[model samples]
Target: MKNSTCLLQPSLATTVALPVIYSFLFPAGSIGNILAAWIFSRQALTKRTQYIYLVNLVSANLLICSTMPFLTVYFARGYQWTYNSVPCGIVNYLGTLIMHVNMYVTIMILSSIALSQYATLKKNSDAQYSQAGNENCQRFLLKKFRQPKFAKYLCIIIWLTVLCVTVIAITRNARARTMEESPRCYNIRVEAGELGAMVLATGCFFLSFMMVLLSYYSLTRHLSEIQRNTCIEEKHLIYRTVKRNIFVIQMILTVCFLPYHIFRPIFYVMLTNNDCPRLNYLVEIKNFLTCLAAAKSSLDPVITLLLDKTFKKSLCGLFTRSTSEQHKRNPDIFIEESPDT
Candidate 1:
């Protein structure tokens, strides 16, 4: 059983080949998240609830990536079981917990942001649509979540549910371990009979994916309406930035995250159905997909800044503060000041 479970551990070759996948990601994720946090600290971002979610999402990614060093050790050490499994289990558990929070919070934040943008665009589209009863619904959502109390309670609920799911996953993995494998560090080895949990995850993933798509669709529709009804080309710079950000969000969900989500149900279902469950090739594919999943932690900050113009501009300001400050000084001060004195 120990050896069989070790089969779930990635081979030395795979780990070696993918060192950058772990090592490079950790620093990039850490720096990106830290910068995002700094950007959020600006007073301008304080008003919106989506900024709160964005900060927490960045935090979750940071926490998840912090465990990469442990994973790096495991991978770099020829995939051998060396350290105490307790810490390994801990890192493993945290990795999953943060991953879950990151995914759902991203869906929640980005979709709401897009929806808010849609509402804004709709309000400016035409007098007819802006005055309609349907506009009230949009306006209500925009304001409802803007309230700190409402957004705070909702965020607490989300974190609590995430904690519950993580505990369950850790408990399940713990209960399945035999004496031999109980004390060894290894890769994520899922066996049969995690379908209920997987189903829940699958449901959440699909629902979030659909919501994101719907929000983007509504946003684009309103944007088009605004263009037709107003001078879009004149204000196209503003719209263009938002559109680019939305495009990056779509790409992240589709390119980085889609495969793992799409394959998760099928992988578990197949494992449950097969009596032996000895598909080496499938395990390799799972590792590859999981690497892509791991990349999300690094990519998320990039996504956040890519999507948020204000945050990007704020971050840029921090780096060039001295230059900006110099520009603020009187240009004449540098022109023969000694002669004037």
Candidate 2:
């Protein structure tokens, strides 16, 4: 029964699902990420930090997406790995590296944004507290807290650390491949160096999660302190901002990514152990959730468009002008409604 179970693992099902997943994602994710990259690239210098992180995110997404075609073809060929050993090593290495980088960059960006919000709130709170003491004190504190220099340095350090780890993982994976006669191509031997590589990747994942959680906790704590002592209006605004930001971040991590991570280890264990039929259902669900998580990258631009007032206004104005032009060209067919009504 154990042998049967091992043999029955859903390798074929996974292969069959690959192209379908790729088809769904390529148009929506690949295209959307590219458009976002283009839009962010054109923004002014003041928009550099957020936009630069976004560009990195988009670039990583593109790199990941670019591999889908190769993957689709590989899987469509029945997971036979006909692309030769070098291409196989390169593809697997690049794909995994990009995936890790994307995950880390996203976490870093969110932490940076959260830290920015926290700093802003802290400065404002300090200024108000100072004003309560004396107007001159408030002005002096405001000048002193005009910028948070450490935030930029912190972001750069996070990026560099993640980049170094990703490069190391890719180099290790590439170096570890060996040809297998049955598979007809080079593959990482799970019992050998691949195990170490997997451990490193898992460590990186946990570290990223830990950093994000800590940053989130700190931000929340600072906000709570500010809220406790501030004026009613300022307190309300700060609370709302903090609540919204926390909700968005939590939704992104828990709703989108947590399920995949939670199930990944379980799936790995099931594959290593004799594959239980029950595990197959869990694996299917995990794959679906992973696809949903990947979709989040594609949906991020849309989320910004909906949530950001400035972006919403720009989109609305563009659409309104286009509609008005259409109405002018065909007055009898398209009638405008009066705002008074």
Candidate 3:
């Protein structure tokens, strides 16, 4: 409910520090996202609903990551619009646009993964697990809405929703925070009574989070019930995979998105110069925190590589290519000559 942005004097630290941070981040993010795009482009991703969403998620991240170099230079120039207005506005618009798109798409994708696991459970379980009447209704709803047949449409809808929501952040003709002194490309403002907007954004984040939480809560309760009814020695393979994916999703939110979402409004205040001089020490921390969310674009590929064996196989080939080819050419090199040579 706090004011999102309020006008104040600019700080020297943010001006200097952000460029330094982005200078390091831009190339890394660009390369990582590009590589991810290549990995996801392989024909295998289309078969799995989860990986399909991941592919889109990676594309969204790449969209944002590709823009960082421009922003690095933009911030490096102390908010000056060395570039003209239209390109700046489009870049400014896309900056917020793709970032939030990535967040929402991530939420949707994780939710689908959780629900799909539940559906899988429903398919394999017996009457004891399905005895609850309301539970039947819930499953009916999940079956109706979260069907695999509609996943592509659902992902498209999520993308459109993100664009519709963030388009409001784009200003006309000028850059994001266009002022006489600081003609910058950041979409910050000092509006009164618009605490509702910030609240809505935060609420959407937690709302998506709560949906994910509820899915896991249901999954946990169902899992516990199954564990009790089934034999102790029966390994719950699906349960383990579902649980692990859910955990990884939560970890992604915690490490990559949570800090930025938590500190965003505060950074707006800082960026707008409302508490500029007093909070100058937070400058470096703020720089790192803000970029941390975008850094997930790169980290997501790492996540894909970890969670997906297919991606791991593909990614490993890039590193082991020459050695593998060499071994293929000379089969005796890999042979163990009694370990004595």
Candidate 4:
């Protein structure tokens, strides 16, 4: 009886708690991402390629958030995958596809932002103080930092790469499914095929993260050089703030995803070998990690509200305007022009 009770605890915990948490998280994330999408679309006037990437990132978050309610219910019911086979297949495919899309999009955006900052810093370092007197010099500096062509090509390459990878993964997944009796749903198993999929996903994540980190490091070094040589305190302040923001965003993503990437393989190995005792504990851990990853979709909105000034103002106004009288008293807050060429 005690062993049965222990065995049931993890499943029960997920079944009971996940729905309530997701109930709140899904709506909040959906609303926030919608607002972010709207704001980015309306106010992001920057000609810089990074803004375009930022917009795409928000759009991807919105897409992910749109699917949260369905996922929330599915997971809350103890991972039974109750949806119809067709819908289940579609959802599973889309969920996996969008996750990778989000990952790559964010990495590209962060890398671009870092590169832009580095270019700006380097140019500022070389510019004569007298040359800086002309406003055109500042405009030229901004133009040098703009990389729309690179951003366009990079985005195309990323989507193409993801498309190819997804096709291969889906083909492998379908082939693996033919061997299973339960053909209606995707099941987590410790088969060689599943292991291959996991390896591919983990490798992609690690590679993207490393690229972003290297770009950030390069940008930081260039900024430091500019500060040391130019003595321009204002640019230094902007650089520090942007760096801090990037650091916070990266930290949030890393913390949310680390457990799943690190522990999932161990769980898979234990399950495949019929190691029941180890599998039990690892299953619980995997459930927790799964919840953590889903929570990122929810958290993305809050992060935007906190980090982006325009979104923050919109959110504040949304909550503060309760009555028509209050609405009349408050004027719409417009986003100030972005500092991009």
Candidate 5:
């Protein structure tokens, strides 16, 4: 076992950029999630089971957002904190725990949404093809994914599985690395199990990523065939909505998640080998990418707005009310004075 000191100091970018990035993420993510929660509150979950997944996604995002201020302070203070301090441990552990939960939970929920949307599209296609009202066996299995009870159970399973795995991994890793503590909170050493866990998580992420890609491709193909065969505007619109939802899910994974998972294994390798000089720079880069992943929480509300009709209605109504109030306060501004006649 290599008894490495905490040689991973923050670079100028890590110190400056992390705090700034997380400072922005905090308020943005908080407001977005709060709005999503409020909007979701008004709707019945049983009527729209996909909202179950979205609500869970928003919950995960909110959990991570709550940790942002502590993280921002930790990074801003040049990554310096007494290793044995209670506060330091709480911040470090919660930050790590919530971040991993957010990443993996987001991955699972979005994958579920994509798969559900694809299943819905296929159901529509089957009807269009006049399959004598016969349900394909595979479609029947996926159809369960769209049901309220199944979605609820699935969300519960996802939360429990992710939380248990993350907690176990963090605890074991911390126990293995706690000898001769470094004065920095983020200076964690990689153990063999941690590396294995990282690789496993990365593999899962890629698998989900590929699933989203396949769903998108399948949707596009179906949409094209439908457009060519029939000019039914309603079918076209339905296909478009499903396609856009899948596309947005793909974009979120690509922008927020791809970089971090891509770099994580390489970072673990470097950290384990103790390439002291280069490892410092790599840590900084890894942290920035991690921030990007966390920023997806801030982006989840936008996803909710796009994907949920009820949420969109609520948001639009809120905006309309705010505008009405503004106009009420100043009627002359809206009247425009007839453009000076």
Candidate 6:
């Protein structure tokens, strides 16, 4: 373990860039999510099922953002955090709790959103054409998922399940650091149980990815059927809108997540072997990709703006109102001139 620690010290770039990135992400993500929370809270009483997911996503992002200062401190000091101090333990606990929770919870929630949209499309099509005549309990459950009550319950289930799983995983991986190793916050040791859990988590990601794809495919085919049967010109616009929705989620997962998950098992193997000559290089890449994954918290506000029309309208209205108030307060400084004037 001591030799592996010596060989896998974070590179200069990793130490410098990760702290800066986390510092920026901390403020940006906090402000964005706070604004989102305010906007969503105003509309909470409207019983929009979509708001359930949006609110939960914002909550998770805020939690993740709150952890960034600690993370910045960790990386800024080159992963040396007073070795087994209370703050170090707190940071490590959060790394296991909120960080991992947000990633996997975001995955499941986004997949749920895609599947919900697909359900909405199916319900609308069934209503219009009168073809879906209640196949089974699964069909009934899908229909139920469209309701706000169902969505709220589902969100609770997701949060509880993720929290329980992550807590268990962390407990299983916890160990005491020895004096032989330099007092460092991070090292290249991978427990067998943790590695297996990580592999299982990666498989969940793939399953969620396939769920989104299946939702997109189902929606496209259903829309095509509608166009063929009724020849509605608006179907083209709806198709494009759905495509954009799927594209946004897919882009987030692919850009922020795929690289980390894809590299994780390989990184684990390399770290575990201790004989890998390029371990330090891999460690740098791993840290950078982990930062990239956390970057999604800062990017999620854009997702809310793109997907929620009311969020955009509320934000625009707030800006417009502020401008009008400013103009009213400074009437003497500004004047409109007509050609006659």
Query: What order do you get sorting by lDDT, best first?
Result: 5, 6, 1, 3, 4, 2
Cα lDDT over the full model 4? 0.56
Candidate number of the best lDDT: 5
**Candidates 1 and 5 compared by TM-score, better number:** 5
lDDT of each: 0.58, 0.52, 0.57, 0.56, 0.72, 0.69
* Candidate 5 Cα deviation (angstroms), residue 217: 1.1
Clashing pairs in 1: none
TM-score of each: 0.76, 0.69, 0.74, 0.72, 0.85, 0.84
Better of 5 and 6 by lDDT: 5
Top TM-score: which candidate number? 5
lDDT of 5 by residue, 1-341 (tens): 13566456677787787889899989999999998888677654324556677778888889889989878877876356666666666766676656776678889888988887787667657666653445577676767766767778898898889878877867775675466465655565421125667777899899999999998997788677777777768556667777888898899999989998888887777766666677777777887888888888888888676666556665776867644344234311000111110
Task: Kindly list the per-residue Cα lDDT of model 2 for residues 120-218, writing each as its tens digit.
Answer: 554555646542335466344333322333434555676688778777766665554433332522122321124454465456556655655665675
**Alpha-carbon shift of residue 71 in model 5 (angstroms):** 1.3
- Alpha carbon lDDT at 115, candidate 5: 85
Ranking by TM-score: 5, 6, 1, 3, 4, 2
Stretches off by above 4 angstroms in model 6 are 1-7, 44-46, 130-138, 173-183, 190-193, 322-341
Q: In model 1, state the lDDT of residue 181.
A: 50
Native-referenced Cα lDDT, model 1:
0.58
Question: Which of the two, 3 or 4, has more TM-score?
Answer: 3
- Model 3, 30-97: lDDT tens digits are 77778877866754335355555567777777776766765565555534542246555555545534
